[model samples]
Target: MLFLPAFLTLLGSVSAVDIWLNFQTTNCRGSGSVLCPGLEPNTCCSVPGRTGNPYTSVTVMHIPSVWNLDCRGHAGNYCGPIRELQTSNGRNTVCLGRGPFGGGGYGFWNGRVAATAESAAEGNCTRPSIVSLGDGTQYDVADLNDDDFNEMILLLTSSFHSFDIVEADGISDDVPEKFNINKLDEASLLPRYY
Candidate 1:
């Protein structure tokens, strides 16, 4: 019927989630853990850190949809389009990847927070707080709904691509010392291809 068109449009608009956060994952992550497009096995063709280091060239983007601008601005040049991930039970999450480079991007970083100074000194952080990277920048250091104990939420201006609600954990340190990356994946949003 004619009404179907209008309804579909309405549904599409409502489902459009704006991603605005970036969580760097370990190497080979951007390619979904399989293989980068047109890339040779073990060869680094990414755009950040060390191209050869698979664990350092990928990012696990977080699209919370709470800010109404989760991931929207830059496209990271080589990153893939954000796509909806599959989830079961009652979990809800979304994600994407930024190929590499330009880690200290624009948007809220460390502007001013009590733990900003401490976070700078400690690097990986150890508490529930926000790090102020000065210059009006601020970053949210919280759980990010993932099981990772040290999740850092970078408020991006916009995300180039987007995915649906899923889970993403594992930064080689998202969990306790007893567990490994594989275990972490069980409790977080795994890279669809990674």
Candidate 2:
């Protein structure tokens, strides 16, 4: 009787192993074809071109936690390259330029690699242009709503403008939660966010 009681008590305490709920049919992906959180796929937003309307391309590289900071100060959390995008009509395709740094701010580029200038120029039609107006000095780009998307804020030597990058098919949804906009300063041999 004691053994039976002990066994019963042990069984009760252990409880029945919860049968793994087979949720294979639960459909984690909502109705949209996009990934979770309702973000469109590869939708890249870009700035207008000076002449023939340059485009943009984007790549995601998980930069090592270290080696993120170098000659360039901490412009963003993860400072890296923005690849230059090729023109749809097959025109001039410049590479993503680099400088002192400023995209969203310190810590914006954390863990992100330089997104190849080629990719940056390709631009996303889905995301809208985030630049508002500017004497074009410095600014911050980020997802104001913190939705893991991106927005641009222009901090020019003369004024400040904020705008959303236009979204494109397969390019719009790749932006980070926020970007440290460091391109508005010093006339250089690089392209401007016109």
Candidate 3:
């Protein structure tokens, strides 16, 4: 299954709020360096350029995997790690690193590999893979190839202002482990929908 890590940081026009779930992130520890301190477990940093060593600055994130990735006989049925990424100019996209700074990917999709994928055993793979959510929404998934699940999922929305990526908390028989995508706040819709 594809797991959206239990944490997300939203820095928007409104405010900066860091939300955390009990899940662990994978970006730190053993990329040719001693494990950095104060990082969320499994999390590592991402940068647009190499102004400094990666283990020093930048924020790390959990990247989504290429679940159904298929390559020729050279590789198949593997979930590769994303190896590079950075925030887009407008914060609208999380793109793969490139140019004098250097990023992975042989060519370009949208002028850069939107995400990077590599199997420890196999080779490279392309991205922006299509997925249909259980809630009936379709998504275009991209990985930054930064060695984690720090990819982007593009969803068509009526408005950017109303769009939210929500992580629900607590467990109740009244509420399902599987979230209802239609209700970002779950109970916020009761009076109107029920």
Candidate 4:
């Protein structure tokens, strides 16, 4: 009986996720390191003492897996709009931003983030679907996973934003090649907004 309880505890710890938020940019190097640990999947948790503070970078650590993170603004709850969605598999350091493209570009969440929700990825796969969610002025696909697809999709929207996912029989040649930010050069630490 003792062994069973200990084993279960160990198993639970293995599935937990640890995320680090920093006040500095470029590889999360700076003071005020806030660690949000043991994060459960699909659950929103507020970062203690971090609300209303300017956070510039983030680092997520998960044992035996990868996960997705949704940083929310306004309050320490999931009900608020998502400010940013980042993956743990790539870069290790994700630079926070104010908003979508033409907002602040990157390197500044600036007291906008209040809470976070984590979604663990199945296996070691990465999300590849990027869609444009624009009204008419801007056509940028930077938002991640507006619709759940077992993986995160970059969704870019403008004035009127909406999207949907469907199964396709085959790939279309006209479809441009998917872009993966993880594959970018190591020197490029900041995410580009266009």
Model 1 residue 92 CA deviation in Å: 2.6
The local lDDT score (0 to 100) that residue 170 gets in candidate 3 is: 16
Sorted on lDDT, best first, the list reads 4, 1, 2, 3
lDDT digits (tens) for residues 3-38 of candidate 3: 322222121112211111101112211111111112
Runs off by more than 4 Å, candidate 3: 1-120, 141-194
Which lDDT tens digits does candidate 4 get at residues 70-119? Answer: 33321222112345555434333344443221111011122323321222
lDDT computed for candidate 3? 0.21
lDDT of 2 by residue, 65-147 (tens): 33121111112212223222222122121122222221111111223323422233234222322222212222223234423
Query: Distance (Å) between predicted and true CA of 157, model 3?
Result: 19
**Highest lDDT among the candidates is held by which one?**
4
**1 against 2, candidate with superior lDDT:** 1
Ranking by TM-score: 4, 1, 2, 3
Q: For residues 3-36, what per-residue lDDT tens digits would candidate 1 score against the true structure? A: 8545544543444221222333423233222111
Off by over 4 Å in 4: 1-13, 45-53, 63-79, 89-194
